[model samples]
Target: MITVVGTGTGAPLPPDAEAAVAGAALVVGARRHLAAVRLPEGAERIVLGPLAPALDAIARYFDKADGTEETDGQQETYEEKETDGQRGGRVVVLASGDPGFFGIVRALAERFGSRRLDVRPGVSSVATAFARVGLPWDDAVVVSAHGRDLRTAVHVCRSRPKVAVLTGPGSGPAELGAALAHRSGARVLVVASALGDPAHERVERVTPGEAAARDWGTAVSVVLCLDESRVLAPVRTVAGPAAGPDRWALDEAEFAHRDSMISKFEVRALALARLGPRLGDLVWDVGAGSGSVAVECARFGAAVTAIEKTPDGCDRIRANAAAHGVEVRVVHGAAPTVLSDLEDPDAVFIGGGGRELPAIVTVCARRARRAVVVAMAALDRVPAVRDALDAAGFACDGVLLQSSRLAPLPGNVTRLAATNPVFLLWGVRPPARTEGVPQ
Candidate 1:
């Protein structure tokens, strides 16, 4: 059996965990964790670094627990021997905070089955950081930038009111702050370092710009990104992200657009389908005349950036977003040029770009990680759009939609009013596909 202890949150070692450590034939942990606790003399110690090597070391020590060479890489299941006044496992893995919460417990459990592990979870760093800020975290989004891409963390922080980011080397506060400083300056970052140690523990609040200006060393435990305005939300029965919108493709009248300049509900529905907006996603709405597409995408819980060339259009987008209770970063610039400064999006929606539509689509398709959707009135642009998507290695598909809505004439009579035909095109990255596009 293997015993995993979660300790770094200033909690005293549990009595059972103390006994486990005392009898452990092989003890594994990070350097800081090892320094904090006293191990039984002569117990083999493996300082955690690259996970595979530590797992291998644990396997070696467990294989020889009975002092016999087990033929296979199996641990000898001898009857429990009493040590430290109790029976214990042959291996103990020490981790910071709740090892079960994004810690070593998963790796250990996978190597040795859950049946072999006795997990003792402690307070996670995320919990501690939120406690320090005196905020209720049930509504917060916690993302770990440890050994993973930082863009997801930035995107979540950009859209959500509360976020907790677990810092790692190269992906720490400075890097995260730099990424968010320009785009998410409205949010605040609380950097907590060396949790559980009274003498060395430090927690500081700073703007993304302030954090970007400093060199936060290796002690950073976690960074809490918060938008103070919406920190408190109504009680949530479900955890993680807020629930996705119950409905989408809102009617044109739902948005305050200029004389029906916005993409109609029919076209917006199919565009959103191909875009597949969700939490932790960054979506770009280029040529957003009324930002109706941008507002709808934001409602789906994605971080949306609406690129509009006209100053008035940008204002309309921002106002429309505020009215709908969603955050959308409106960039008052044209696509294919302003797009260079913005982060690559998970998806892009290009609506009514005129002759520049194909060029914008090419640029967006190249940078979009998942898919791109374009809406056009002219069939002449179809070949160029298809070529752009194909050149960017996307599987291109499209549909031409013509719809009619009920119109009231004289004497309580209703007649179908034909809407202009629109061509909707989408290109998805290979092998991955999402559901639902309107006819």
Candidate 2:
């Protein structure tokens, strides 16, 4: 039998839990974890460093009892059985904080199914750290930077203002502090360490720069309280493109393009409606001329990918993106072919395709979560796009946009100049399942 014990937040195991751990013949865990516990006088202790050797030790214990020779790759056993001599040995695994939440208990279960082990949990570091700051954890986003990539953590902090990051030695407050320091806007960083222990946990409130300067203690978790009232820049503060004329689907003259080519403001507005760019969504703009739609979508906090064939168009898109101060990854290549190697997008927008509309839309509809196709009076291709959408099981809709902007004529008099009519077709993939939640 394997007993999983939590030492609490830097505290000793409870009396009853200690008894169970002490009675076990073998104890296995990190060196620090093993050193902290007083083994029941003669209990055999295993110091865990790297994962492979530690797991091999656990497998050996089971092999000795079952009278079975150890086999490579067949290292796990679920149920405990009786031994020949009627003497049953017990093995106890130690973990920090709550065993189940981002702890070693999960690894144990995956290796030697849940039936063979009994878990005893304690206060998690996240809970202890939050309690130190007097913050409610229910609404907080909890993420770990311990032995994991910081990309998701950085993205979470960028999107959500309130977040708690569980940090380890190298991945501690200093690293996170540095990330937030360079990040635009105002934020209050809280570093809490050695929580719930007699060491007297320290909670420091500092500016991102100040926090980055200090060397944080080991086993720290950082809580970032974002100041939303703080604005990143003048244009960025404006929430969405639909809020005003200047906020989105910018005027064609704003970008440098060949032959006055653009997606047209009217068509862009419709594309935004169908694409629904938001946080956690990925939208691809294929045949992106000026990247106006892609940039606008990024403002709404969606990850955007713009595919353009011409080197000039790609450069123009990047320049426009930097001007707006939003991220829009521009890939310099032709679509349908170029897009095959790209990550699957949540939605796609097709801006230019002479005869490739059907094949492009078909491929996008297959890989994309949703797709929008824009056409400029290529009447023969409309039926093909519609048929492709139908075959891909998408609910399709379309609208024709014909805008006449009032312009000053050569006689210094204003006149409505009719632009070419464009066809906008959109298709949305239905959600797999939905449970109604009150808005």
Candidate 3:
């Protein structure tokens, strides 16, 4: 049997785990974990660096006991041997924190079926880090940047108030801090390093700027990115992000806009539905005139970047975002060129594109993982936009929104004030088609 054990933050191993370790014929784990645990003099030890070799060795050891050699890439299992005064066929894999949570237990289970393996879990690093900070973590979002892209973690810190980032060599506190340095909102980055090691355990709180200035060598384990103001929210109904905003597609008057430049509420509601913004998603609002769409998406718990050409428009977007108590990264530059540096988006909303409408739509469609929604005031541009989306392998659909609001004239009489019509075109990437056998 393969037993996966969690060593919680340098604490002494539990009695049951200790007995397992003592009886293990093969103990596999990191150098640190192996050193901490005592093993029988006759036990074989494997220091986990690249895990494949160790896994192969473990499988071979078991196969030898069953008098069978692996061949043709096929798996073989062995029956437990009865040895006097000892457990002769036990294998133990050591891990940090909870073995089942983003740990090596998954690898072990995949190699050896779950029925043959047992898991012993401990407190996760995220839990330990929060404990060190004296904060409750039920409301926090946990993301890992270990051997994966850091963009998602960065975006989570950008939009959410509380986040615990599991750091790897290149994607640690400094990298996280540098990414948030230019954002409008303030964040406190708690760098927790060498967790569980009494001599090396350290939790340092710093601003994004301060964090970027230093090199926090490689012992770091996790970083807690927090917006201090909202760290403790009113007793939550549900955990993680609050239930979607009480209201969305807010009226234009709620936002600060210039000369009625904001997209009508009707258009925004459809765009939002198509965009389907949610936690862990990054949405781009290219040509974010009043940032109405950006603000709304942020309200729905998506990270937003508002790209506008004019400096004034960027400022207006920021003001509207702040007024709504949300964070929106406003980039003061034109699209297609400026968009090259921005992170790829899950969904995109294009409110204005000037003569570069088709080009902008092409770029957005190429990068957007879900859907691209575009609003055009000019009737002549609809066909070009549609063509651009079609070229990008998107299923295109559109509607001309012409709404009229009730206006009070005189003597308690109301009249329908017609608003300018806008063509809303959206493209959804087709579900991947599967091939069938020929008849």
Candidate 4:
């Protein structure tokens, strides 16, 4: 059987796990793990560099471990080793705390079946960081930026009130801070570095700007981004992120819009369907009349930025966001010009851009990672917007949405009051490229 021991993070390895490492015929770990352990005399060691190489090395031992085949140039086979009063030759993979928790355990388990693995888990760095900060982590959203795009971490930080980001090279705290600095200044970042080490461990709280200004070395364990006011939430019965809003396409009366200028409920329903906003996604609502679309997107757990040329509209967006108990970054500037400063969105909703509709769609479509949904009144602008989306190489589809509401006339009689017709157009980047990777 292959034994996997989780170490590092300041905790001493358990006696059983240590003994497993000592008995390992072929030991595999990083430099630090190897240095910390006391290996049995003349045990084969593989210092991890590239993952495939290490897995290949481990496979060699497993192939011969059954004692059915000759050893890899070794004098004795596993049967002989076991008969000589030693445990049958087996592999031990050392990894950081809770290797199963977004660590090396997955690779090991995938390569060598779980049935073959005797896993001993240590406290994960995420747990250590949260413990250092003295907060309950059951409510925190944890994401790994290691070997993945930093944008996912950034968006999680933007959307959630609490988040723990596992830092990796190029996707570390500095990179995360720079991405969040301009957009989410209200958040406080708790930078936890070298956790579990008494001499070098640090848990410092800094603003996104302060974090961006520094060069944090490779010791970072995790970064906690929090909106302090909402960090302490009610006890969570269900773990991971909070659930998405139970209801969407909220009533128009729910939002504070300017003289019924918001995207009507019917238009919003289809627009939201096209924009598939969810956690870890960045969504833009350009020309957000009252940020109805933006607020709705935020309710679904997507990080939203509402761009409006009017200051009052910006305030309304913020107010609407606050009223809905969601966060929406409100940028008070016209689209097609102001969108340059904001980060690329996973999805975008164009509500009202007037003559700038085509230009706005063109800009948003090019940068949107997944889809772009546009809602318009003028029939003339639909062709231009479609052209722009087509130019951006999106698979464009649309519908003319016309709905009627129940109107109370006289004596409890009902009439179908036809709302103004709206053109709802959506452009989806083909599924092959829709997985949030920028083109």
Candidate 5:
């Protein structure tokens, strides 16, 4: 039996939870987590500083007890596959704050069954940080940069005026500062580090560069209040796209690209249909030659991620984002590989992928909330891309886009100039079935 307790750092554990830990035989947690608690004198204490090593020790303990084969780094899988209905042993895992809120409790729960484990949660560090600043957390977005993606932290700050990022050594205030530095506006960055410890420190209203330079103590959470000198308008209390852009889809010449490289407005209209871009949604403009789709999505208040391969193309996307006066995060690199560490997107629109289109389509279709891929050449690739999306559980569909524009002839008479044919392939994720299932 493993009992997980949240010490909540500076805050003391609740009466009932403290009693639970005092009665436990084996306790597992980080050094800080361990220090926060008052353990019984003879309980076998396991310091969980390095995750792999600590999990190995747990695996060994369980192996010896059950007379089963020993596994090291695969403790969670081993426990799940081997454990019968019997109680293994008395163990306690401690974390900071409410373990359920993006805390160590997830790791523990993934390793051990929730039924066999007892969780005694304390006040979440995120809650404590917000409380210290006298801010309500109901609408706050809580993200952890602890052994996970920092892009979420960066993107949240980019799109939202207020965000709370749980920071770690590499993903601390410095990293956030660096991401924020891309924008020129001043931000009121509050770093709350070591909240409950003796060396607790809180740095308020520091500039991005200064926050980057400071040596923030352990277990830091950053509250960034964007001072919107750069933002033309304040975020409206009501969520969703601001009603300003007169049209949903604009003309083909709306964006600057290399001689007809932009996705045609007609095609973009259908792509948007598949994309379903809306407020609070995150969209990706993969192979974003001119960032046209991404810019449009951002216009509708959907957070956009524009991925481009060429250096010149990346520069164009950035310029386009700034020109449109919307926050569209631009990532520079080739598709599929460059897409490695990005946040899961609500929708993805591929515009320039060639043979790599299928693989790119496959990856995005599997991960994104919806996807659309467009290609001008390589007619053979369409079947493969459609097949990939279908295999990845998307409801696959496509359309061929052909457009003609009237131009003045030698006599000043208008003549139709045919544009190159382009194929638009799209898909959407089927919503979960709630029709017959009891809640």
Candidate 6:
């Protein structure tokens, strides 16, 4: 049997794990984990560097002992010969914290099978980090930057109030801090390094600017990024991020806009519905006039980027976002040009694209993973935007919104005031079809 063991942050191994390690004929783990455990004298030790070779060795060892015929001769050279006294060899795979949580057991299970793995989970780094900080983690979002892009982790830090980032070599506290240095809101980055190893263990709290300036060597286990202002949330039945905002489609008066340039509340509500912004989603607001849409999207827990050409518009967007207590990245540049540099988004909202509506729609629809919502005052640009979405393989749908709000008259009475009409165009990417799934 292949036993997957989790070594908790610098703690003694359990009796069962100790027994397993002592009896293991082949022990495989990282250099640190290998050095920590006492392996059987006769067992072959494999220090994990490039995992493919070690996995191949493990498969060969297990297959040979199980009396399985080797069809491929690849593993024959590395196969360990059994001694006269030994019967069947036992394999032990050591992992940090929980092997099942973004750990090596997944690779092992995929190569072998779940039935073969006997997982012994220990405390996760996220749990340990939160414990070190004296904070409750039930409301926190946990993301791993190990062998993956750091952009998602960065975005989570921007949107979520509390997040635990599992750091890798290149994507540690410094990288994360650098990304958030220019972002709005006050954040406290708790860098927890070398957990469980007292000599190497250190937990330091730093600002985004401070974190960006320093080079924290390769010992960092995890970084807890938190908006210190909103760390403790109100008691709730649900955990993690709250279930979106209570009310969306906020009034136009709520935002700071120039000459009523913002999209009306009626139009914004429909656009938000189509955009479907949520946690872990990145949204782009191209030609953000007053950033009303961007602010609203951010309120829904989506990381938003508002791109506007005018300096005043950019400032207004930032102001509006700050006023609403949400984070919206204001990019002071024109679309189609600045759009290239930004990360690909899950959704895109086009507020004012001018002559470049088609080009902006093309770029957004091309990069957007889910949907694109566009708000336009001119009816002439509707066909072109719809055509652009269609060309990019998006199923297009649109509606013209015209609303009348109640206004106080000179007398002690109210009158219906009609707002300018806007066409709300949205395109949803069709879900990928599975081979055996029914239509």
1-439 in candidate 6: lDDT tens per residue?
7888999497788899898888888899999999998888978888988889999988877777756646655434234555433545678999999888889988999999999888888888888899998999888888899878898898889998899999998899999999888764688899998998888899999999999999999889899999888999877777767678889899888999999888888988899889998877899999999999899999988899999999999999989988988889889998898988887899999998889999999999999999999988898999999999999999999998888989999878999999888999999999989999996
Q: What TM-score, to 2 decimals, does candidate 5 have?
A: 0.59
* Model 1 C-alpha lDDT per residue in residues 268-386, reported as the tens digit of each score: 88888889998889999999888999888888888999999999999999899989988999898877788899888999999857778888988998899999998889999999999
RMSD of each: 4.3, 11.6, 3.7, 3.3, 10.7, 4.9
Better of 1 and 4 by lDDT: 4
Regions of candidate 2 where Cα sits further than 4 Å from its true position: 8-12, 71-87, 221-439
Whole-model alpha-carbon lDDT for candidate 6: 0.88
The superposed Cα distance between candidate 3 and the true structure at residue 337, in angstroms, equals 5.1
TM-score of 3: 0.86
User: What overall lDDT goes with each candidate model?
Assistant: 0.87, 0.73, 0.88, 0.88, 0.73, 0.88
- CA displacement after TM-score superposition, residue 33 of candidate 1 (Å): 1.1
Candidate ranking (TM-score, best to worst): 4, 1, 3, 6, 5, 2
Q: Which stretches of candidate 1 lie over 4 Å from their true place?
A: 66-89, 409-413, 431-439
- State candidate 1's TM-score: 0.92
Displacement of the residue 200 alpha carbon in candidate 1, Å: 1.1
| C-alpha lDDT of residue 252 in model 5 | 58
What TM-scores do the predictions have? 0.92, 0.56, 0.86, 0.94, 0.59, 0.80
Count clashes in each candidate, considering only residues at least 3 apart in sequence or on different chains: 0, 0, 0, 0, 2, 2
Give the candidate number with the greatest TM-score.
Answer: 4
Q: Is candidate 1 or candidate 3 better by lDDT?
A: 3
Clashes of 6: 2
Off by over 4 Å in 4: 67-80, 83-88, 432-439
Tens-digit lDDT string for candidate 4 (90-207):
6788888998899887887788788877889999998988888788999999999988989888988988999999988998878988999888748999999888778888899999
Please list all clashing residue pairs in model 3, or write none if there are none: none
Which whole-number lDDT from 0 to 100 does residue 111 have in model 3? 90
